[model samples]
Target: MQQIAIAQAAEGMVLAKDVETGDNRILCGKGTALSAAIIERFRRMDISHITVEGHPVVEEGAKSLKEELLDVENRFSKVRHIKPLLYLKKRIQERLIASRRPQPAAKSEGS
Candidate 1:
């Protein structure tokens, strides 16, 4: 889940956690699929930010999984003939891919 500013909240994005007012009153529950009107309402209410499900926003210059893996392979190209180095490269690729995969959001105490 990603915590983002209200201006960044787009329609159809699911809420990862309950959005509350300053007094702790829930404005919207978790798992809500936001719409444009609802987002506007929140803005009017002065809600600054919210937590949304998944990592939807892609920052510029961010390398994709494939791109990163290729970079690792290129770095070890000269030593590919060495069996030990090849094994090391394979391990690095495996770890890289695993890291890029989505991780389950940790459960909060209140949930």
Candidate 2:
């Protein structure tokens, strides 16, 4: 069986490695960042017969991932409507105080 290296692997490409019989395939398999997405797609396609090797290039790709995650967090915070609750509470308190106060009567023209 031939051993495939991750550096030579590309997304959407099938691995040329082979698994041995009675071996724990999942434990033996290591993957790269390119391989992770490809593996996911392969899983979705029900193609799980190939063996993979190498750790994901997560450290190498961390900057892009961090930026994407930050963007998602910012978008979620914006869509959560948290500020609207505070504004509504303040407006309600103001209205309640206004309702509790006594209004002054208008002066008569003759007086």
Candidate 3:
């Protein structure tokens, strides 16, 4: 799931989490596919951000996974000799790869 600014949201994106009101009431449940009207309603409700089901929105100039992993490697190079630090670096890389994996799109989500 990815939390993104509501301005960046568009129609057809599925919600990964519930959108709640200020009083903790669910305005929209998870798996709700966004539509123009719903988005507009959210705007009027003062909602700033929401969690979407997948990494569907791509920003310009975002780094690829290879570049990101290389950056992690470079930063951890100095501590590669330290056993604990090396393990931590490995775990971080694992999580990055896991997060970047494609999620299966829901075909009947909105239906």
Backbone clashes in model 3, listed as residue pairs: none
- Measured with C-alpha atoms, the lDDT of residue 108 in candidate 1 is 30
Clash counts for all predictions: 0, 1, 0
Query: Judged by lDDT relative to the true structure, which candidate is superior, 1 or 3?
Result: 3
- Clashes in candidate 2: how many? 1
Backbone clash pairs in model 1 (N, Cα, C under 3 Å; residues 3+ apart or in different chains), count = 0
Candidate 3: stretches off by over 4 Å: 35-37, 106-111
Give all candidates' CA lDDT scores. Answer: 0.79, 0.40, 0.83
Q: Write the per-residue lDDT of candidate 3 for residues 7-111, one digit (tens) a residue.
A: 988887878889999999999888788888889989999999999875777777988789889999999989967999999999999987866665554432345
lDDT of 1 by residue, 1-111 (tens): 677899898877778889998999998888777878779989999999898876666657977778989999899989958999899999999887765454444433233
Best by TM-score: 3
Candidate 3 lDDT score at position 90 = 95
Q: Over the stretch 1-111, how does candidate 2's per-residue lDDT look in tens digits?
A: 113343434453323243323453432222222245554554554444553322222344434434554554554554456887656545655554453333332221122
Between which residue pairs do clashes occur in model 2? Answer: 33-57
Query: Cα deviation of 68 in candidate 2 (Å)?
Result: 45
TM-score of decoy 3: 0.68
Off by over 4 Å in 2: 1-81, 109-111
